[model samples]
Target: MATPTIKALSAVIFALSSNAMATELRIDNVKLYQPAEQMFSAPTSIYIEHGNIVKLLPSTHKQKVADHVIDAKGQFAVAGLMDLHVHLGSSGSNYTNFQYLPVEAHFNANLYLGVTDIVDLFSFDNVLTEAKQLQQTQTSPNLFYAGTLFTNPGGHGTQFGGKAYVINQDSDIEALWQQHLATNPHVTKAVIESFGGMGNTLTDTQLAELGKRSKAANLPYFVHVSTLADGKRAIKAGASALAHGINGEDIDAEFIELMLSHNVTYIPTLAVYHNHASESEHQQISHQTELLPVLHKKLQGCLFDKVPEPNVWFKTMWQKRAHAYQNIVKLHKAGVTIATGSDAGNPYTLHGIGLHNEIDALAMAGLANGEIINAATINGATTLAVDDKQGQLAQGYKANFILLNENPLQNINALHHINAVYKEGVKINREQLAERNQIIQPVGQECNANITSQTAQAVIDNFNDKNQWLTVSDSAMGGGSATELVLKDKVLTVKTSLGKPTHFGAWAGTEIRFKQPNDASNFDGVALTYKGSKAPFTLSIYHSEVQDWDHFSKMLPASEDWTTVKVPFSEFKQFGFGNKVQWSAKSITGLNFVWRSMPGTPPPVPNNEFHLKSIGYF
Candidate 1:
């Protein structure tokens, strides 16, 4: 370690500060864990300027007074983990597309989760271009977002997420290439989910055009090929990578032969797979790891008034997804590139925990510890075309690494025992980072009891009154622990539990139960107090039962600070199932909520997490 110009601050001290100063990060007394090399260096001090890492100095020098200093005694530090297939622009599988954060919020969430980099796999051109700007400015984790996926005209990502879209028949190779590159996206995707995960192969001309054009533009292409058919096409089309490893079906040795032949990277979002796996071993291992405390706590909070069987799909997936990765292991040994992917913000997986779960699943895949680290660090960086400065521990490489408590080379689980995470040169305290990285919780997990004063007022209004009633997104999906809810004055907060991009996208909204014997009339309106994204975002109220499947009311616009909006009751409708008989909803029991693209779609009715202050008759 080289000598530092000044001293560094420690985690214990940073945790005690009344407010974060937001610059100058220094870390000392840390054993750096280099996963790529499978080695741990002795004690060293790291110096950070702004948020980027500036230098790695020796701990022998007396530390200086930096803005933030994290003490990493008896701990290890490594690069912040990266999730390749994470989703934040939308909420749940319904694709209300609301979880995308204000740039600052997203950055802070990723930082806490120890996610130094992220690839929002399915964002739109406008949304992604903006995020790329933030990344360049270093406002958030190094970001790489594909503007939107390209499925067959009516394929999967097109209708599912309400993301930006342009139809290109596989026949129009030139038009296809032009449209994809127009977004200035990080990567383009082919929605394989449309073909039941087997994948709808774009024609040879289309594939050849993609290879040529992307290569010409210096922008690589990625595909969501979750099956053998898709895997084969990605190879034939020369796709740079595949999101989510081959799942649900067996991979023939011939397919493995093909992947290695094309050098196409495979990102198995193992965490999403684990959440949906049905096998006991996978479940037990997932539960036994350090991620268990956070994962279980989140799932437990899914109950809105103890509703039964919510988030059951998560457990069921975990059980059924057991054998899904057998082929991935063969690939690992076959010298195929199987990178880490969390597919965070899906129905069962959130952010920070998603990375942890991915690491765990990778371990189950029989990967060498060094290989897993490479997958998250170098491999992901390679796919993003930022390898020049993102991965590795070379002097000129951006100062990004994680300090582990144990040698990951010895046991892959050591990745979870994070002591510190350094981005650029600034070293973040592991504990502080973990607290912020936690994004979403499971369906029945506990939740923060905190609520903003305005939101509290709403909760109280409903609580004290006998007739106050409402419906909401999945409770556990809404907020992790009741305790996480915080309201100072009227501004509400949704913070990450990890130090990077691990945790993000949990919102809460309420729907009123039309229990009035006379049948409750429509709500007069809804009130919201929120801190919008760095740019702007949309908040919407849906009066329908179909989550992300029905027409939605107008979206209330947003701003940077805590602001309020009152949606008109005219915007409300009788969602076919509540107490409004004759004109009443005959079966739809709950009115759902969702968040739309800040400058994008108006979102279909979907039960996404929304932080609310109040909803009622004006």
Candidate 2:
């Protein structure tokens, strides 16, 4: 509920002074969150030698004066927080907006929030390698990562427009795993989705094969799922963990038994669901604009859009989150290991900062403050299979913890009230971090300005011949709606009717691909012609085969007359959050036409219909 203020970013005329470090360090008379008892320990003196916690002694005991000693009372200490699910290298300002933020910004975001360790579920392998190295040389959290997200070709992973390992068949599993291992990742990530609830997932044989190969390699594998069916299927296929909890349903007895018996860890990632709720509660952003200019432009655009009334889909998502939260409590009661994963670096989920929200959400799901702390700390380390080295305060364990101004055992929100962070016996300068966050600018890459050309042979589909286009709809998941691509009289007709209420909406659509993925680098825009009845509908175009869930969209104006809609490459923003600029026209994918209501508007009328004659680049 704390709103970040402009003064948080205002320039200050103070220099950062260093915290003196020594070979031996003592933290005396501080309340400790004891993992063994799952409660705060009495005032204790923690002795550290050579970056390791060496002793937990009675504060009253007289001992050799240490090389450096902190205060003698009235502070709380807990194992530094760990976020199990995060995308450390992602800008996350938008769904498809891409930016390469400085490593320091990421470190500052987590450290400022008292998160001293993080496990990134997906990112480019090289980027993860760099982040791992940065952790040792800089004052950053202990970093762990799953090198890349492996999934079916053109599947969930492809929507992000990033480099990913595509699993076309069983053979791809070993190949992708070997390539990933070359980067020395701590875990592997895979995704299973029904194409936004409109398509199909990989065959059972394929999933089993992937799971089999992953287990054979003796590595921890995390599978991403959104529905109960997929979650159960993934577990049966031998997934080591579920990256996110299922929505829209409760965790039934079967789910509880399967996970408990299989020993599969569950990362609820409630932060993402809470983000959807926050989006529905648009008023939350009105007072935060003063902090906007300090962030990237794409982030600014996303914030601007959230200031409007809640959209129908966002409202559905907000309500659906309750179901997921309930499932988390059920799973925890069934003895399923619950790890706190923020799914950060997604919309509205800031890295490092978002983890606190996840912890808060877990508390709301009926977890005690001690249990929540354990989930955020050791539970995450256990999920990442690195509990031996990190996650707790004990002799031989890494001397990593956060000094808190208040006891988090009494109030979970106290986790955000960070006083100082000690990683491996070295202290971080909080004032210096504040200054860095205030002055840091976004490192977004600009597109090439000189690249421009017109498409001479631009026709993609004339609707005169048969082609492979698959329609997907929310009905696949439980929504009520049917859709079809009917080509008659040399025109393609897209028709739909309202179905049951669903968070994603009751609609149908398909992705149209070129003969081969066209790298339309020479072209600069797309031109399409269409006409529709008096129904509210939208047309989306995927300009390239980038894995980004982005497209150029325009409302198909309702008219008895044919209308020509041209979406210039420059006009396309990534989920309405990009700086409409330079882009590669090559690799143009397909078009998706759907009947859905826009946010802050009434639901669409029944029996929506539209027609398309031609689509091509201009």
Candidate 3:
């Protein structure tokens, strides 16, 4: 565990002690983890009066002065959580209005989940400002938010009503950003939706210019980009954080390095996606869980009517919302910043209760209770710029805490054991929260059977290797010939025994050519494995139909040893290049690996050695 910085400590202390003039109440006998940098454990006492921490003293000092005293009695009291990507003021409409989300209820919702501060990056965001003011006038949750997502003309979130989701390319986006700041949403939310969901639509120059302006304006510019070209483009654009993991893109080392270099923080809304899709169609929903009953009831009352009666939007929403937490384990181990957020307000997924599901998903994602808690707590605060106050338990932080009958850190499901919730100095008993918790508990059998990290890894690994394949293309005639892969002195390698593209045209006449077919069978794909000479080599695939150069072609990563990789089915194209696709075989048999997108077209006897190897289908 990395130590929290001194700056983080100072921020928490500042937030706690800021309201020094408030009344005083002492809370003692709790184990505190002020994760701002240090670990303090003792019979610590917090002196909070009127919604703010007045001082942190030893329990012995509690007798000196205080209006009310709460005996923590060894309860694990940590700072409140911060949810950066929350959907506030929600309904069935593309936008949610604050009218439906009352201040009292909204504040109570945060208190229920131990989330003291929040950032509602949605339409009708003025409510956040009001909430902040309410915190001063009336007791409410500390809230900060972004007005709305700025996007391109007909870009990503066009149907999302409320504020303008579609920013016509012709309109001045910077001007719109300026207008947003004027409204005081705190942060400026921007969109870099991939063009046609194939490539990042934003240009580097545009990003640099926008980045400069956002920095100058002293606003953190958060981007909502997904997979393939869009993700590649936006990360290269220098972003503060990526709203989602490479949603439509495959996870690879190169992309990971890019994110690391840019220091891009990731808020993987895995629940939003996985809540719908799973290993099999039957596994998509928790068909056996007790949550189904609660979820069904919640769905009944939710803007279920808001979804079109005949539309398959709900179905489609789940289908597209497929994700595996394998990436979380990978990133966590890789030292990537992974935070928490529930992309709620969609369907079935609601606010308040939605976060618990997110926590559940984290457990399924293989994150330990400690990591998951920190991700949702401290890490979340960092994402929302509220770490100074929330996300820890210390002397000066706000007195937003929860007491559960069971330790959620031990079993994430224990999150349901909510015993008590405190907002500032007032205690809202668990009963108040349960009536609206909407969280379904597992009954007789745990539909939500706890699958530990070991099991999850095995499942994920098996899923990756399912339906594997090795696609071989037609070799252009010329001198290009094909042969079986061989191991030269124990080192497995491939040699281009026969063919070479003299010019960049088709295999001389096409008769001797082999190919990769773009057909339904080829979709939902498989992986290709081949050993390369060494690193620093380029493996490229191309087709004439690939009009967009950036997205036109794809490349295979260079690996030292023979490696198997899974390629998503959507990558194949209707390009007029490869001539031989032998589907009749029903399987890749005796297929000759042809062609290598050569690096400098010079020698290696021009288009050097190419080898053929086994391909796994998944």
Best by TM-score: 2
Query: Residue 124 in model 1: shift from native, Å?
Result: 2.9
Off by over 4 Å in 1: 1-29, 42-74, 91-106, 129-139, 161-173, 197-201, 276-300, 303-322, 428-618
The CA lDDT of each predicted structure is: 0.55, 0.71, 0.51
**What ranking emerges by TM-score with the best candidate at the front?**
2, 1, 3
Better of 1 and 3 by TM-score: 1
Instruction: Please state the error at residue 554 of candidate 3 in Å.
Output: 38
Q: Candidate 1 residues 348-413, lDDT tens each?
A: 465565776687777776777778888877788777778777766544567777666677778877
Candidate 3 global CA lDDT score: 0.51
Per-candidate RMSD, Å: 16.6, 14.5, 20.2
Tens-digit lDDT string for candidate 3 (1-618) = 999899999998876675443346777776555454334356677777666666776665534455567788766655565556666655212111111334445555566656666666665655555666667765455666666666654344443434553444534666776677677766666677543333224456666666666667767667776664555566776666677665433567876777778876787776666443331244423332422322323333232322222123234434443344666677788877777776655433445555666777778768877787788777876665666766766545667776644555556665544555667767755445445434432122222222222111111112122222233322422123343433444233444332432233211110111133222233344456555543223322332122222112234455666677666535533232322222221221121223443312433322234332543345
For 1-618, candidate 2 gives per-residue lDDT tens digits of 997566753423111112232337888888878776888877888889988988888777874457788884678888888888888766545433345566667777787677888878887656676776776777888777777777765466655556788776777777777888787777778888873565445667777776776677667779999888899998898888899888667778998899999889998887776664565464432233322322445445544443333334445657787798789888888889888888878766777767877887888788888889999888877877778978888778898888877888789878867777887888878777766766776655442213333333677778778855677666554445677778888788877776544434455655575543565556667777888756756667666433334466665567677888777777665564322323556545566777764322445666767788888777
Clashes of each: 125, 16, 43
C-alpha displacement of 523 in model 2, angstroms?
30
